[model samples]
Target: MQAESVGIVAGMALVLKFGRGDAARCRFAISPLQETMSALLVLKDPGRHGWYLPWLRDVEPVVAGLDLGLLGLAVPSNGHGPDFLWPSPTSPLTRIEDDLAQVRATDPAVVAAELAEQARRLDRHTVPGDLYRALTGDPVAARETLVAQQRTAWRALVEPLWDRMRGLLDADITTRARQLADGGLEGLFADLHRRATWKNDELHLTGFRDGTVDLRGRGLILVPTAFGWPNLGIGPTDNTSATSPALVYPMLGTARLWEPATQSPAIVRLLGSGRASVLTETFIPSTTRSLAQRVDLAPATVSEHLAVLRAAGLVTAKRRGREVLYGQTPLSAALLNLDRF
Candidate 1:
């Protein structure tokens, strides 16, 4: 069946089945972030966001809101209603978490330290100038400062709550609902990818489509979403949800991503190496140093190459520890997979 049809049907089945209890349990487990994400999600993706939980499997792990694709907490989390769900009537110092009593449905204390720390760092208390100006209906005059502050508070909010085994949420009615709505996470992400920007780090997908899965691996790591499942798994050349372990953690850039991520800088370089100007239909990575290594190349040369690949929409890069790590643009990756199949 078409992914569209499959996703829709599966979603319907999920609501019919787990709509009440399990869904509530799942919501109860996390901080107000889930609610904020769900709210903001409604803005960008009404269908997937509107009381309808988006699902995914064999796909890019996406969190909610404008569907923020981890621009990096050098970059952070976003969404609407955070103030309401994880409300903070006071500023700079206030409890920004939701009532754990509700999510006691999950073992909150099990992940309490992490959760407490996260709550302590929320946007509500540490209102970034950008967030304050933006929320208080201030002018964009201090936009840059606002943006910086926003990033800080945002990262604080995003840095925790990846692990939550809300007892009632697992193997419950809600889980069944998601299952019915989605063959699994793979189906959900596929459908959402089609509806939102499904890029690597550039926000380029603009609601692109998917191809076949030609790879899978144990190196894979999945980040959990508000829905209580890993949003998507980053695996080696070959990885899939069915084979990988479900995961959660502090932040995307944590060393753990490297530990479990099957992401290959080598493959990215090999795939993107191309001097053929008229734009050879396909750029193949056939270089040493793996586009990620910036050892010998002059900083200018590296910049030029990155600019080119980024322009061609072949790869993605984010500055890390004074270095830029590049990877396949989600669209490009999907395209290559389509070719492979």
Candidate 2:
């Protein structure tokens, strides 16, 4: 799926008007496929997605030989790809396989129409002649080819790092859920994005195609994306469609997602280098084994350091099954000057 861009008008906003029952229906969702699709945008313009430079560098060799022509065409530079590639996820835990299946099952007619629309929207020079012909010649075959490419791309680019990415996305959902609990919709939308403002039971999203979407009680789905930083995306730009509208916004702390935790010199001086390294690795929750792998220490040694840190009130541990996950405490965050967002 390509990153779809709406026409931007200065000070213009897309207003989503909600009816009485919409608030009860609003919900949050996590889509692995959505992240995978958004990651493609990062690859296309690495300069704009500097937060993912580390990840892009790591995956460079893995994706070098992959046949990504169709994928590249799908995510044109203009950012108007077919919406069918991103079917509204049915649940919060929607899997990549499920999302791919939905894409495969898309009607060939819809596929053809969307592809034609995309070709019309994009520069003629950008769409290769042969590829466009093949896609237009047999829409069914084109869809299959696209699905196969998507699977290959997912395996090469996303599967290995999905665990860490999912953790960040899940953490964002937890934070958003708490905001909803503590301050209701107002507080939740208050800081969702600089351009998003909630007023009069309407969500005003600036810099998007000027339009008003009436949510006749169907509500909205808020999707938190790890790859979609510095921009907001709305789904089914056509307001007449029955599908529940969705807003894909960048999650907090994405800047730290691919960053290696650096041991603070002050903490190293205070707690010794080894213990300081262990504590820094807990900036994101990690098991002793993972922490050891990250810090290049033996698991037993990392476990010992974790024990000391826990005793010192600098780290906290929670058991998930047999493995205990260690995380930095607020005290440690203050000492390191790390923002928890």
Off by over 4 Å in 2: 1-7, 90-92, 265-278, 286-293, 296-326, 335-341
Clashes of 2: 0
Instruction: Name the runs in model 1 displaced over 4 angstroms.
Output: 1-32, 35-227, 230-303, 311-313, 316-341
**Residue 76, candidate 2: how far off, in angstroms?**
2.7
| Most lDDT-accurate candidate | 2
Output the number of the TM-score-best candidate: 2
Error of 2 at 143 (Å): 2.1
lDDT of 1 by residue, 126-157 (tens): 55554443333322222233233333333433
TM-scores of all candidate predictions against the true structure: 0.21, 0.83
Kindly list the per-residue Cα lDDT of model 2 for residues 58-101, writing each as its tens digit. Answer: 99997788887776776655445788877777666678988899
